[model samples]
Target: MPSYLEFFAGGGMVRAGLGGRWKCQFANDFDPLKVQVYADNWGEKEILEDDIHKVEAEDLGRRADLAWASFPCQDLSTAGNGLGLGQANGGDRTRSGTFWAFIDLMKELKATGRLPRIVVLENVVGLLTINGGEEFKAVVAALDRLGMRAGAVVVDARHFVPQSRQRVFIIAVSKTAKIADALVRDEPHPTWHPDPLVRAVHKLSGKCREQWMWLNLGAAPELKKTLNKIVKSNPVGVDWHPPAETKRLVGMMSDENRKKLAEAKSSGKRVVGTLSLRMRPSNGRTIQRTEVCFRGLAGCLRTPKGGGSRPRVIVVKGASVRTRLLAPAEAAALMGLKSKYRLPDVYEHAFKVIGDGVAVPVVSFLRGKLLTPLLRSIKKSRAADDSKARRVARGSSERKRRGQLELRV
Candidate 1:
């Protein structure tokens, strides 16, 4: 079975997407809460609940077929501090700076001849433009230095789920691995290669550009589910806002959003939409306003660190409109997780684990379309080489036996 090492494995969502086909050789994360959640779902046999920097290459045991890192994005996300990914050689000490530690680990693995055949890095789409796109180049360059060919695609969770979370997946393959021609393209696909990513690729240094790959993920699948389908009407762990509070929520809506609410109420049918509070300038003073989206999709789930960033569910049926915090289970469903997936009991802790994870279906799509096929090709190639070597050795042995018989005669 193919094996992988999952870094920054929040709640083991990647393992959930990888399914039982792949063996998880090692998993690491620094947050105690996230580690506990991951252990609850995936067990603690392979999990190391410690900081990435503290992990040594030897602790990873045998080399894995793939290494997946969904590193901290706080420094690289647009909503974050924009500190970038520090230095390529492990200089910075910020949250996102942990990326350098991952790189350093890969370098150590390579030195010890334990480097994985493939490496996948997942993070916010803002990674493509952070620090004027220099950081993206540095990442590709780092892979290049490891003698790997690197390519990336921007995958939005909306394609596979009801959430509008867009993340960039950087897939790097060892230069020695066998890759099928069908898995690459001369140009980028419009869906996966947005303008920012295209620009970032074009900006790579000449040497690194030579190793760049335009991965062909093929066509995106149609979204079969919507926000309404994923959201539970009578969600548990959260209560609906009282009449006065609900009125206040509606009153905070801007004129445009209020019109949307009015339209929903007039439809005479139930409407489910997501609400978020944004600070908008009014009369030269910034005031908080509630914005609602009725496009059958939820706004991207985010860590509920503060009140303004928390997402709310708005249900409008005829003249009555109700609002409430989005349930934890609903958040998990939005990330393509099954209902049976275990989550933390505390609401904020559960939201943090779910929000700070890769969409399960997106990872599954990449696994089926790219990673699995690539690994199969590599295995096939190695098997063929082994068979040829065995035949050669047999021939040599037979000749030696015949020579001995002649000498005896």
Candidate 2:
């Protein structure tokens, strides 16, 4: 089996998806919290928790059969002001520079002629639009310089889970191996075209205006799951009861905010947050509590760093729908994490991990279609090389025998 080294190994999701078929040799990531979670699950493997730039080439070992990197996307992400091509500002170039650091590591291994046989990189779909797609071009050019054939696929999390997350994955292989050109995007298939650009965006025409066109692109694919599947069937009983003050605020969303919701249209009914407000006699302070809906699909899960509050819902079916923000268990289920997956962190950190992870079934599909084929190509190349070596040896023996017979005559 081909061996692999996974970098930026967040919670070991990629490894978990691929490890059933491939052998994982080494893995590394910088986040201590995520490392702890990863180690909790895959403690038997070598886990490196250090700055990736400092990792020695030899540490990756002489024969890295495959390399995986789900590189940091903050630089190119819409979350980061779209500072993709130029020097990333905010005095925090650390994450942006990490991609270069990865390239440097690859160069070091190349010196020993045992660089990874294949490389896979994952990032947010925003990378395609960053700098008008120059960022994607730069990545492809880098792999070309390293003599690796590369292709990219844009996958939506809704394919596996209810959440709508779209991530871009780039798969590359060394030039020494020759895979069917069809596997690359250059060759289009009948059912599914490998060309990502063809499927990148969906264009629509306005109903009233014949001349108007709309580009509704980067939107997540729709899944058959509804909010009911995501929520707990047997909630047992309501917990985290909202105080009276919290209930009042939900009643007080401004006319303007409510109008925005009315303007936004969705096929399924919409849900909105409600508030209950109260004054604290002890501290002479006012507090607001949030109520959510249990009948609709959830909004995106977010990291809870004081700013990343999960969206609340209070109204459903155009009426006052009373509910609470999803409990930790519900959020985990929405993200497709196994119920038994140990989450040792506080609710805040646990939310962050789930928010950052790839949907389990989405990764599994990618492994089967994109990764497994590349690995098989490597094996086929090795076998062809062995057969050619044998043929050459046999030809040499025959030439020697014919020469000896001529000399005997």
Candidate 3:
């Protein structure tokens, strides 16, 4: 089995996507809550619950086939302060600087001839435009300097799951590896990158562009899954919003949203459920806004701070109208995490874990189409070399035996 390393490994979401074939050689994360959840599921033996900068790559005991970093998105996301890479804004900026530390480790490993064959990084799509897209280009250039063909694509979870999360996946392959192009040179990939990522990649400098890799996984133009399909229709014993709370949610709606709710009520349908709620400035006053989705999809999952960012599922069944936070299991389903995956005890922390994770099916798609095939090719080449070595050994042994016979005669 190919061994791997995961840095900033929150809740082991990457492992869930990579499946059981790849062994996690090392896991590192600083958050105790996330570490606990990861240990509960993947076990504590391999995980190192400490600051990643403090852990040396040499301490891993063996070279990993791959290394993945789903680094802290807090400094890179728009929902965040957006200090972004290479800025000096105190510890938050220093925290995002951890990416450079990861790069440093990659450099150290490469120097020691222990560099992983593949490296993958996941983060919010905001990284693409941060610092006028210089940060993204610098990252690709950094990987290129290490003699790896780096490629990036923005994948939306809505394509594989109910949530509308668009994250950026940057994959780097060793220069020695041979792999097929994901994106066609002259042709456009309408499904994979309708616009943004392809555009950004085109803008790469000639040298960096030369080191870019592409893999065509044949993603669909869109997905058929729905939010209602994954969410619970009848959640018993959970806190359902009372009439007073439900009235507040309804009264907060704008005229257009109110009309939509009225229309849904008059349509003779017994049930209608809305996915999200937002607080926006209306006429200079902060007002709550909830737009019931007609599209059968939920808004992106976010860490529900006091700002009311966590989405609510407002259910209007028959004469009863109710609202409740999307259940933790529901959030897991939205991220394509399996039913059996263990979540944190506190729902708030659980939401943070789930919200920041990569969608499982998205990772699975890459694994099946890009990662698995690339690894297989490497293994096949190694196996051929080993067979040739064995044959050479056998021939030398036979010659030695013949020489002994001749001498005896």
| Full-model lDDT for every candidate | 0.90, 0.63, 0.77
Q: Write the per-residue lDDT of candidate 1 for residues 181-297, one digit (tens) a residue.
A: 988999989999989999999899998787788999999999999888877779999999999988998899988999999999999888899888888999999998889989999
TM-score of each: 0.94, 0.76, 0.87
Better of 2 and 3 by TM-score: 3
TM-score of 3: 0.87
Q: Write the per-residue lDDT of candidate 2 for residues 123-232, one digit (tens) a residue.
A: 88777676666666666656766877665666766666666567777777775677755455433332222243333321111221121112112223457776556655
Please give, for residues 113-148, the per-residue lDDT of candidate 3 as tens digits: 989888998888877877667767877877888888
Ranking by TM-score: 1, 3, 2
User: Candidate 2 — which residues are off by over 4 angstroms?
Assistant: 85-94, 181-224, 233-249, 252-299, 311-320
Give me the displacement of residue 229 in model 3, in angstroms.
Answer: 2.6
Best by lDDT: 1
Q: Quick one: RMSD of model 2?
A: 8.8
Q: What TM-score would candidate 1 get against the native?
A: 0.94
Best first by lDDT, ranked: 1, 3, 2
